[model samples]
Target: MVLLGCLVEAMHANYHGSYSSIQNRSSSIRVAHCMTGTPRTLYKEEVYTAYRHQVLDVLPGDLFVVLEHINKTEMIHGTRVRADNAIRYKSALKYLSPRIVEWISIGDSLGSIETRSGYAKWKRCFDHIQRTERINGMKYDFIVRTRPDLYFAKALPKPSKLPKDKILINPYYECVNDIPSGYDRKWAKNLDLCDLTNYGVSDLFAIVPRALAYPYMCVAYITDLPLAICGERAHQAECAIKATLHKANVTYEFWPFVVKIKHVS
Candidate 1:
């Protein structure tokens, strides 16, 4: 009976292996998108030009931009920021004046969005991307989630090798060990290859496959982690979590040291 059971298991394994080997490879074209919104203060022409100059420097051609705002009509109608404003100059380059390929904006209150909180806002941005993908029949090999308020401290790191599992910003122990720690523990449990340590916070700065983002969107939500405030204060929580977490695979790269800070003030 034991030998017969072994024979059955081996046959099943072989059949499954053959089936998986024939699966088609996903597309390699990647789309790196930034999700931005308006700041509290109005900008002068020089400030706006400087902002545009700095923004265009780090932006790549292969990107899908998403601009979120509290009010779109007010913005486009010139009641908020004014049409002749530099904000318009930047917005025009992407979606309004003359869209040059991959830029768009959605009213913050429109659609099924969640922007009041940090974590919710990030997930809502992911949701927007997912809906856009479905509508346009677009599929990406990689999806980089970036923030608009961010200033590049260095060059973006080349993406790491995509593992068979999800690439998390934190360490690999939480998933492998089946232990409990960190914020959003439920979110941690749902992931196959995840980190409770950071909850992929640096993902404000991430490069992940589109496929992985689907499951993560529904499950592996970002939790509270140490954050760098204007490069002055490093959130100690994330630093501590990172220090304690075990490193199994080299799936993430820290890039703050490399980003060239173009705007400050």
Candidate 2:
């Protein structure tokens, strides 16, 4: 039997919440929190406040952090955050002190907006896992991909061991005409129009063994743009991931958990 190991990839913004809850439950799990995009103006201070409170208090097995800087000229929701300000905002991460941290430069030049974004998201998570394995010289049994902006109501249950070809994904809240309702209406409607039969995997979280994660996360690189771009941004993301997983020939099962999205304040 494969030994139980986990690598938690928390990508996106950091809001207030104790990951310690998870550590308390499983001391062996390694965490890689990846923060991306320009910080939202509405909750800039709040984001830092939460990061300092929750992320800084790392547990014993928390591996490292990947801080990817967004381009200053990039407009996210009509806001262009200055590079200097981003640097300043990231400076505070010093409190993570003894923990290993890496800063990566990111820009719009990576590829077409949708494809590049999807690629970057998956690449960061995959890269970190590879890095940890290299440094520790050990392979992980499972990899958990998640977002920092989310707050889990309780400890996530330990993933059950599965055949190397199988993965564990959370079921989407709903599917409107086969389109995931978790996406915005425009994207959802567009996806529904496309009528993709096997397109309901929630991108929010996934737990898979290292054997399958390599192919699953590398989907962005191999995705067919013409097919994935049929829907809006979120829809494009869904299609890319789903398409890639299908090509990789991986089967999935859902692991239930209660998680809530923390709004920007």
Counting clashing residue pairs in each candidate, in order, gives: 6, 0
* Cα displacement (Å) at residue 23, model 2: 13
Per-residue alpha-carbon lDDT of candidate 2 for residues 1-265, written as tens digits (9 for 90 to 100): 1112323354443322223222332545444443433333313454444444433343223433444554556467898755464455554444433133444455532322345444455555465556556666565655555544454443444333333566756555453334232212223222323344545356665656667776566554554433442334436466666655666567776444444456755
Per-candidate TM-scores read 0.42, 0.57
Candidate 1 per-residue C-alpha lDDT over 1-265 given as tens digits, one digit per residue, 9 for 90 to 100: 0111111111111001011111232434444353433422213343334334433323331333334333433454555552432354354333312111222233333222223323233344454455445545665455555444444333333333333345334223334444333222323323556433334233334555565554333222323322332123234323322322222122343222222123435
- Model 1, C-alpha of 232: deviation from truth (Å): 21
Q: Candidate 2 at residue 106, lDDT?
A: 56
Clashing pairs in 2: none
Model 2 regions more than 4 Å off = 1-60, 70-100, 106-117, 159-165, 175-200, 224-235
Q: lDDT score of model 2?
A: 0.47
For all candidates in order, the CA lDDT equals: 0.35, 0.47
Candidate 2: residue 208 Cα off by (Å): 2.3
